[model samples]
Target: MLPVFRRRPRYSIGSKLTLIIGAVFGLYLLSVTVIGYVMYSQYRGFSTLASSHFDRAMTAAELTRDAETIAAEVFEMLVSSERSINAGNRRAENLASIYQATRQRLDAVDASDVVDDQTRAELDRWQQPFFSSLERLDTRLAAEQSLQAAHLNRIDELFLLLQQLPPVATTASLPAADQRFVGHALAALSYAAAALSAERPGQIARLHGACQQQLQQLAALSLVSKDFIELRKRLNRTLPSIFTSRRPLLQHGRATLATARQTRVLAQKLTSTTFNYHLQLKAAAQQAITVHQRMIRRSLFGLLLASLALITITVGAVVYIRRAIVLRINRLSAAMHAHQQGHDGPIPCEGHDEISLMGSTFAVFVEARRQAEQQLEQANLHLQQMNAELHRLSEIDELTRIANRRRFDQHMASVWRRALREQSPLGLIMADIDFFKRFNDEYGHQAGDECLYRVAQALAGELHREGDMVARYGGEEFILLLPGLSLAQTEKLARRLLRAVRSLQIPNDQAEGHMVTISLGGASVVPTTHDRIESLVSRADQALYAAKSRGRNRFCSAVADDQNVMVGGTT
Candidate 1:
């Protein structure tokens, strides 16, 4: 069965090439059209976001500065017997402006442009300071993290202690009352342990309720556990200690838990406001850019397939066309190869035919790809800088502008361990303002905050040593860690700390000195494997108590003996 296959009549080479060049140019135009459409859509979003973000951010900046000026003017009005009426009027005007700007930013800004992160430079400036509010939240988070660690450790210890005793008598083996109490107490301990990680406001309320329940269970268990211990002293040896460790949490844990809840709430509010603002802007930009990139890639890939097929077909067609036409085809191939090698070598664009148009289209594609890559790189860099700024803000204290408690703890621990290894003496001074509570009661919290700032600065100024650090321990209390300082050096430093506060000479009628002053207790010791931190802290506290007892505004030192414990007295 032999079949004769007849070949279809071949078109002229010019006809074949006309079709190829026309089709490729048509694809080029389609790509250009689609790209224009995508660009317009993305540009609207990007530009609106940029402009809106810029305006609001600038407005916020201006308002903050204006507000500060207004505050200063009010202070001047208060302190000066003869204040400038013009300054007062200017203050009023700035206040009004700030109020209006804040209102506009919060409520009246255009809905579509509500969240824009267009200007990186402005965001860089604004976001860093805006995130300063989160410094307070960071302190709270560190406290919560510490609480969580403590809770976990106690729970683990409670379990280990529980393992030392026999399990509860089975329900069948014991009286109903005994069994109920034992089961409920165990369940409550578990609940209390689980509550440590609950962060939501609702979760905190539920946890409080659970804590109440746990207390009830503990009360019920107390009677039974006591009776059991009375009956079987040796077998229930660890139960008393376990209950001691576990029961106080139900009673005294509310403050810590409430603080944690507040921390979580504040952190959520602050981070969602600032961090998420940038985060969403970055996301939107990336998404639009990613879509644009995908479209470009798809176009480039389609063009690649078309070019390959066209070249193959046109090469064959050129064989029939002419040698001169064949030379143009070779030039086109060279251009393709150069593009592949990341070169935009000269393309032979001598004619106004389809091949010349193809060369132009391919050049545009290469240029667009390069531009897209550069844009993506810039976006990535912006995101990284914001992240770094956030991290830096978290470690700083926004108010007192000193090392916060968390920083102090970290620095102290690091220095302590290093000093321990080097066998160097480390000194810790715990100091507090005399009659600060009374000062707050009389002058108010704002005044107290100002006083704290003043005292912290004065204390910081005294510590010129490289390894010395002063930190705001809490309200009205500051701690200083001086590495490689002996008892004498520490006492000298402690005295100097007291003098610094006295130098402030801020009027405080409640204090014995008739001005703001501090009482300091210092402890210095060489680290030992056998020693505990509590021992050193206890000595310092005893000295502090002695200082408070003797009188206010004095320095006291705790001397260590062979027992590796502090003996408290005035130095």
Candidate 2:
């Protein structure tokens, strides 16, 4: 792969910085552009949806209202027909005229399609029964009037209750109180003219005049309010008196009947129109709400998608840059340190990517740095040696000369690696003075130092070959490295050292029984193969723990074949 996009050197640092800034800016712009596209798409969809639904809802509302209005007007006419007929003032002809006008109004409501069959039936029931009752009352009155010219006493107080008969029992029934009943009554009245023509000619002419006057007055009655109660009462009494006086004297019984029917019809019409209008408005409002919610949801979804895409791109960019630059820099930095220490080979090259190219360039820089480090290393070596000597001088107790921590780490790595490569059996022993800290307080730091030195000497004396090495591991601890030794031999040497140290009888005031005892942990491994350094150390450490657990003044050996663990000593 190519390392990186190359830019001309003629572009100054400022120019390069500007270009990088532009690239970052362009990424932001692209995000904004995508978001804008989403928002714009949502806006268009919402606008289109709103426009279509709004007009439809409004039109339906208007049509529903118009149909209900016409139904109300027709209902009024039907009620008036009853009034004219009962008063004995040519009521049938009057009905026939108003009925025609009411029919024209009802035809408009039918065209609007808001009224159903049930509504039509209700209207017919209210108007038909009422108008029929008027005709029946007229017939009864004419017969009674002709008989009264022969006999006068039949017209009595019993005639007053004729109006009190239930409307349902009449020739045609009256409407219910609600608005739907009013619409039904209106539809019924629209066809009343044909029914009225069945009345006699002299009565029909008088009925035509009565129907015209009643229509004018009933239409005006449609505007009745509580505030007009007095005016309504006066008109009610006056109109009935004038119309009733013209009737055959025996027809007086029908007065209240006609008035009641007209009232019921008016009430039904007002209720039906108001209720239908209300339903239409509610439907329109619901449609608007549904459309609004859809628009909001679409916009929110667009925003969510855009936000997710932006986050994904941002995370991807961050990961790519980190792997490309940060990880490579860290690897290169580690390799450079090892080379400077004269401890490792050159860095590896895996690709021609920017990180790889940078690594290659850094390798050259490190080589030059290494030459410089060589001169520095020589000076550092001399200084390090002096520092080590100084540390040994201060820390080494006069009685026991062994490697301190300052010197131990400096030598352990080299010796351990060499032993591993040679495949020689290597043995390690860790010896600790039981209760050394208490012993030191009981005695003194000098006495404690002396006691430690003597113990170290005892361990050194047990060693028989040049391959065996002894060192003071800590204030009251010592380590012995024995090469070419098996597990049995290493244990024997450790036991001997423990015996020698015990014989010294160093004062350990903290001891409960035998004082100044020691514990030894040993490991013997053939170093012919390169095993892990940590694993070897861990095995030896485990052995030391076994010895300590068994009690002080003992030695533990790790069996290398099956890695058998044993703590062996005379307790």
What lDDT does each candidate get? 0.62, 0.57
- If candidate 2 were superposed on the true structure by all CA atoms, what would the RMSD be? 27.9
lDDT of 1 by residue, 266-320 (tens): 3344333434444544565566557666766776676667667666656655554
Q: Whole-model lDDT for model 2 versus the true structure?
A: 0.57
TM-score of each: 0.37, 0.30
- Tens digits of lDDT, candidate 2, 353-399: 55565566666666666677787999899899999878777655445
In terms of lDDT, the poorest run of 10 residues in model 1 is 562-571
Report model 1's TM-score to 2 decimal places. 0.37
Question: After best superposition, candidate 2 residue 428: deviation in angstroms?
Answer: 0.8
